[model samples]
Target: MKRPYKKTDLPVWQVRKFLEPGPIVLVSSHWQGKNNIMAMGWHTVLEFSPSLLGCMITSANHSFDMVRKSGECVINIPTADMIDTIIAIGNSHGPRVNKFTRFGLTPEPAATVKAPLIRECYANIECRLADRRLVDKYNFFIFEVLKAQAATYPAYPKTVHYRGEGVFMVSGKNIAMPEKFRKGNL
Candidate 1:
């Protein structure tokens, strides 16, 4: 058994550094002949069946209004190698900049949404707004994944996850123990 380590009080706002879930995905939105990409880390998988994903997009973000009005967006998972691109996109403004052109990212037409997929990313999930109940209160958007695609070369791409305050961690290794789980759990 391992020994318990000493603990220290953490600020409530800084708790995200330890509680941040999932990878930093690039959300693509298109509305009124414009397309934009923004990096998002505040998202979670709500359900497995029908593929529900909940993302918190601050109202101040340019993609928020575009996604709200268009009712659709594409969530693209980028590999760890594209960390620089992700940071650039997150730091830049949307309306004044064309991310696809500025970042030299190829935009491919999505099958179920107007938003284009980033060809360089490992996977792209097309989503449609399913619920807006929390949008006004928390700027949260529940989306039902309509279509998903991924690269077959790497079983799982090395994804980058935020740790707050300009720090990031890259996904490493996979430990599969499906047999240890109860029948349908895996």
Candidate 2:
């Protein structure tokens, strides 16, 4: 079979466009005496059995310095209803803006880390830095999940995913697949 479209030059900046269709999450961290939060989209799973995750925080972000210093953070996943709030959080500077108070966000103490868990989120995953070897070169950090929390009702809440260039997509419809699998997969 032959491919339909001819190959074209791909720009360096658009490299992440294909990989950018991921749920937006808010990363909260604490360092010194401050609690900071940042909206993140560049994260992926490293493992599922033990639940390891990898994230990239640019050097310019305010949460980068705090997460680097404290070595701990909370990944808070919000529903599609909070898309506007997420954009506001991402646009504002964390150092000058008190997101929690300004956005009317409720902060709850995390079980395993100093970072606060956002009560409004659908899920919150507490994490600790697992490796920092690539942070200097790539601004990437490997995190090990310490604890996790999720809401019970509305099991499949709509989640918003970023598609780059001020655009987003929302999760729709839930489907179940019956297939062979391990008994204790969960």
Candidate 3:
């Protein structure tokens, strides 16, 4: 048996590579009669009650202006089957490419907001801006989830995660923890 082990310092630029595995979500925004969709990978769960979440959208993105003005958006979670479409959607600019038309995606009207939900995605979360304190400095928007919908086959639904630089990975295997969560006092 032969084993090879090596250790080397990772480049500063590659630090993002370690944080790249977060779930990828398609953010759709509509304002002043214009709508756009952008794929993003950097987001985090901020709270449990009211479902607070935070996501970063660069000021350069086409959806940024719309979302900032509207103060609402939909976060659509795509399954592994839509990996190619997800990549295509993220690779092209929204202004030039009508993602719905170019990527063959279906847009369904959302209940609480103008942002359309991608019908092809396995899950959709409607969110409204909860705080705008970090937008100018970090392009981060804090959202309070309004509603959520998910497919029945949530166990191992093969969702994709970004690995940086045109790389992606699909979700696999499900595990259940034994401990039960304690309810927090509101």
> How far does residue 100 in candidate 2 sit from its true spot (Å)?
0.5
Residue range 11-129, candidate 3, lDDT tens digits: 88877767775688999888887667888898999999879999999998888888999999999998878878877777777778678888888889999999999999988999999
Regions more than 4 Å wrong, model 3: 1-6, 180-186
Better of 1 and 3 by lDDT: 1
lDDT of 2 by residue, 129-175 (tens): 99999888999999999999899978887898887889888989876
Ranking by lDDT: 1, 2, 3
lDDT of 1 by residue, 66-158 (tens): 999999999999989999999999999898999999999999999999999999999999999999999999999999999999999889889
**Candidate 3 at 182: error in angstroms?**
7.5
* 136: Cα error in model 1, Å: 0.9
* Predicted structure with the largest TM-score when compared to the true one: 1
Residue 94 lDDT, candidate 1, scale 0-100: 95
lDDT, model 3: 0.86
Whole-model lDDT values for every prediction: 0.95, 0.90, 0.86
- With a 3 Å backbone cut-off (N, CA, C), the pairs that clash in candidate 2 are none
Measured with C-alpha atoms, the lDDT of residue 72 in candidate 2 is 96
Q: Which stretches of candidate 1 lie over 4 Å from their true place?
A: none
